[model samples]
Target: MTTFRASGPPPAADPAVVVVTDLIVFAKHLRLLDAARLRGVTPLFVFGPETAGRDLARHRADPDHPLSRVPDGDVVHVPDTSLETLLRGVAPWLRERRVRAVLNVGEVFVEAAGALAQSLGLPGPGTHAAQVCRNKLLQRLAAPALAPRWTVLGADRAGDAERFGAYPAVLKPASRMSSSGVRAVAGPADVVPLLPEYGPGELVLLEERITGREYSVESLVRDGVVLWAGITAKDTNEADTAFFTETGHTSPAPHLTPAQEALLLDANSAFLGAVRFGTGMSHTEFRLTGGDRVVLMEAAARPPGDAITRLWRLATGMDQDAALLDLALGTDPVTAPPRRRARQVYLDHPRGLLTDVRADDVPVHWVGERGRWPDLPPAAADAPSRGHAVLVSRSRGDLLGDQADSRGRSVSVVLDGPLGADLDAVARDAARAVTISAVPLTPAGRTGEAVR
Candidate 1:
C-alpha cells in the first residue's frame, strides 16, 4: 500500500464581503469595510430601500451614508428600488465576478440578497430559508419546543380576543430588524384592534410575553462550521425606555453561568440549523427567565446592528466586519485565543429634534447641521420633545444617563451597568412617544465637515 497526497494551487480572492447599506454616504461602516479589503478580501456594498423606509415616499439622502466617503473602487454598489429588483440586478454581477460568499450586512437587505444569489445559482442560502429568518411570523413557526407560543396573524384582520395572550404579549413586524417596531400588547385593547389598522400591510407575529432579562448572541459561520461565537446580556435604559432603545451590554455571558450560556447557545445554533443557514452571519435575541423558560425573539441572517458588532470586536479582539468580510471572501478569520475581560459596548438613544451638538463642548468634531444633522435644531430649551437626536456613546452609563440631563432632553446615550426599568411599561411609552420620525437634518452642516 502507498500513501499519496493531492495538492492544489494557492488561493484567489479572500472571501468577498457583501454589505447592504441604505446609501447616503460618510457612514462609519465604510471604514469597517475598508479595513477588511486591505486585509486580502474585497468589499462590496449593496444599497437598498430607495425611500429611507416603507413609510417615506420622499427621498432624503443620508449625508453620513458610508459610500459618500469610501472609495468607489473598493465597493460594488447595487442600487435597490425594491428587494426583488435589487437581487435580480446584483445576481449577474456576483456570477460574473464569481463571489465566494455573501455577507448580509443589514436586516432589510439580507434575505433578498441571499435569495437572489441562490436563485442565480450562486453558492448561498435559498430564498425560502432566508424567508424563515427574515419574516418574524415565519421564524416563530419552528418545532413545538422551538416555536414561540401564540400565532402569526395577518396585519389586516382583528386579532381575536380569545386567542390573544392571557398576559401581555409582544408584536413583531414581518421584516423588522433591530428593535424596529417591536411592541408589547396587554390583552384585547392592544392586540385585537391592531389587526385592522396596524396589521394590514404587514404580517404581525404575536408572541406570549416572557418576563425576563434580554440577551443577544452573536455568531459567525465558516464553511458550515460555527467557528467563533459569544453571548451578551442586554441592559436597557430606564429613563428613555420607550422604543426599547438599546442602552447597554456586557460580554463573556453576563449573569449567565456555564449552564445558561450553553442552553442559549444551543437554542441559537438549533434555530440557525433549522432555518438552513448554510453561510453568512447569524445573530439571535432571546428572553431568559428562570426554570429554563426561553422565548426566541428573532434570528437574523446579517451582522448584528446598533454597534454590537463593535462590542463583540472590543471583547474578543476580532474585527467582526473583517471576519464577516473574510466569510464572504471564503477565508475564515483566525481567532487569537482570548484575552480581555469586562469589555462592553453602548450607543445613545436620542429624543426630540437634534439641532446643535457639542462633544466635550469643543464644537463637535466632524459633525454639522443639515444632510441629516441639518443646521442643528433651533436653540429653544424647555420645550423639547422625546426621542429626537440619538447619539452613539461608548460607555454604558453615559448613554442612558443623558435622559435626566435637561440640557439634553432631545438627546440620549447608550452605556452599561443598569437602569432599573419596567420594560413592558417602557415599551408602551416608547411606542406612544416616538414613532420613528426624522430630525429634518443631514450630516453636512453649514461648514464642510460631515456630522453623524
Candidate 2:
C-alpha cells in the first residue's frame, strides 16, 4: 500500500507551552509556571478531572494554596486518563492554543505527554522512551549490563519458593513509582501475601538487592546530551526494616570517591543512551556497592520528586523547574555555577496517630521557622512527614549521627550553605529542638494513649 506523507514548511513562530498535571498530589509545577510567565510565556495548564477538582477544592479551602493563585483562564480540564483518549482531547487543544510543547511533570502524565508531542510534532522524548523509563522490567532489559540481575514474573510465579530462594531480593510492581507496592522478600512467605497487590496477570520484578549506599543522579538533557548532572546522597529506612522508605538526602554528595563518581557518570550515560532518552530532565538512581561498584536502580524521564528540585536550586544555584520549562519551550536551559551544599533530612515518626507537633526548640538558623505544624491525615503513615524545615548553613558537620533515630520520629530538614558550614551540627541541633507526639494506633486501627 502506498501511503501519503504530509509535508509542510515549519512555522515562523513557535507555539506556547502546556503542562499537564495530575490529582494524586499538589501541583509541583508552580515554579515552572511562574518562570514561564516571567519569560513572557503565558503557558496553559491542562489538568485531569481529579486533579482539577481537587485543585479547586484545595484552593477554595486554603486561599494561600498555589492552585488558588493561578488565573482562572489558564486552566483546562480533560476527562480521560487513557493515553489515546488524552492525546485525542489534547492534540486539538494544543493546535488551537498554538502550544509549542507539552510538559508532563508527574509520572502518571508522562505517557500522555509523549503521545501529545508525537501527534502534535512538538519536542519530547517519545512514548517508547517514557515507557522504558517507567517500567522497571523494560529499564533492566534496556540496560542489562548497567542494572542488577532481575527477573519478571507473574503474580502466581512470585510465590514460587525455588524461584526466589535468593533471600533479600526486592519485589515491586514493574511500573509503579514512589515505592508503592514495593517490598523486600526475605523468604517465600513474604512473597505470597504481596502478590495479590498486583492484578491477576500483572507482572512484577524480583531484583537481587545490591547492598551499598544509595544515591540519585539528577540530570538535564538537551538533544540527548547531558548538560548538567549532580549527585544527591540518599538515606533510607533499610537498616531497621525491609521497606526502603527514603529518610533523607544531601545534594552534591560530598563523600563520593573518585572511582565511584566515575562509575556513576559512565553508568548513567550508558543507561540513558540505551533507553534512547533524548530530552528533558531525568532522575537516575544508583547504589554504590562495597567494592565501589555502581549498580543502576531505575530512572524517570521527569524531574526528581521529594523536594529534590528545591535542593538542586539551593545547592547548585540552578532552578531545575525553570530549566525544565525552558526545555519545553525549546529554549536554552538555565544554568548556574555550583555555589553551596544542600541536604534534606526527613523526620521519622513511630507508627501512630499524630496528636501534637512542636518545633519551638528548633534553632533560629532553620529556614522554615514559621512554627507551622504539618497536616496529619487521620490514617496517615508516620513514614513521610509534611512539616519539615529548611536551612542554609556555612559548613558541613557531623549531623548524620545526631539526626539518627532508631524509631525514625525525627523531623525532616533541607538545608543549603557555604562549603565550610557545620551542617551536621546544625542538623543535630535542629533535630533536638523539634518534638512530635502521636497516639499509638493499635492493631485494630484504634488510637491509644499518646506517645513521644
Best by TM-score: 2
lDDT of 2 at 376: 16
Lowest lDDT 10-residue stretch of candidate 2 = 392-401
Query: Any runs in candidate 1 off by more than 4 Å, and if so which?
Result: 1-18, 23-28, 31-36, 39-42, 50-84, 91-98, 119-126, 154-156, 192-199, 237-243, 336-338, 341-351, 359-452
Query: Could you tell me the TM-score of candidate 1?
Result: 0.68
Q: Tell me the lDDT of model 1 at 121.
A: 44
Q: Which segments of model 2 are wrong by more than 4 Å?
A: 1-15, 23-26, 49-54, 60-66, 88-92, 158-161, 361-411, 439-452
Q: Residue 178 lDDT in model 2?
A: 72
Best by lDDT: 2
Can you write out model 2's per-residue Cα lDDT over 145-184, one digit (the tens) per residue? Answer: 8777777775457445447645678886787777766677
Clashes of 2: 19
Minimal lDDT window, size 10, model 1: 1-10
The local distance difference test score of each candidate is: 0.51, 0.65
